[model samples]
Target: GAGVSQSPRYKVAKRGQDVALRCDPISGHVSLFWYQQALGQGPEFLTYFQNEAQLDKSGLPSDRFFAERPEGSVSTLKIQRTQQEDSAVYLCASSKTTGPGYTFGSGTRLTVV
Candidate 1:
């Protein structure tokens, strides 16, 4: 992909179902980040990756939240035991080694019902 790409732009999950969101970054991009944006609030960083190594995940709210970028170009965010409070727009971004700005993908709107 020439830019960051996310799939299933909208998702609706039953209360206990788990969901996996995918992100494909631009070719050669070295940095990737995941964020969760709640309604009426700014995006909150969830995790960051430099190439295939996950550098930070301190912002992940709970053990059920997980993110990974393996082989360096693509990533996935998985949430277990979906809950209403977890509903938010999950955003994925990529940059060139800490570039001042990132190219963000159209977020995946997750709705837990």
Candidate 2:
């Protein structure tokens, strides 16, 4: 089975630009989650989707952040009008169920200038 993976392990963006990062979850997984982790801080939940249905998105910081899991597997997180504060490691994880553990991608490190 394929493990979760994320692209552009590092990114540098100028403030006010838009960026899109991609994530590929494991096959047949029913739950997917996105999180943001600031330097030296724990990962914070950003959103979650069960298949193509978005189950939760309470943790998205602002309107600038948006995510989607269209095909019930692959997902993308897009940031509009990037700001310095948006700099962080964006992580994606998936699980067979809402169980205890999840498989996480390496994450995309975004740096807003």
Candidate 3:
């Protein structure tokens, strides 16, 4: 992919249901990141991966949230027991390195009801 790609641009989940969001990063990109954005807030880092290795996951709100990049190219973010607070736009971004030059996906909007 020329840039990051996320599937199911919009989602509506019943409270307590589980949901999975996918992200496909650009070819050969070494860094992948997941972020969460509320209606009026900036994106907050959820996790980060460098290749097949997960380098950071401190931002995940709870054990219900998980992310993986097994092959280092495609990634998934899963949220278990969705709650109303989970309603937000989940964003994925990729870059060749750590600091800049990132290409961000349009984001997956999840609305828990």
Best by lDDT: 3
TM-score, candidate 1, is: 0.96
Decide which is better by lDDT, 1 or 3: 3
TM-score of each: 0.96, 0.96, 0.97
**Residue 76 displacement (Å), model 2:** 0.2
lDDT of each: 0.94, 0.94, 0.95
lDDT of 2: 0.94
Greater lDDT among 2 and 3 belongs to: 3
lDDT of 3 by residue, 40-61 (tens): 9999999999998998999999
- Model 1, residue 97: distance off in Å is 1.6
Candidate 2 ranges beyond 4 A from true positions: none
Candidate structures ordered by TM-score, highest first: 3, 1, 2
Report lDDT (Cα) of residue 4, candidate 3: 85
C-alpha RMSD (angstroms) for model 1: 0.9
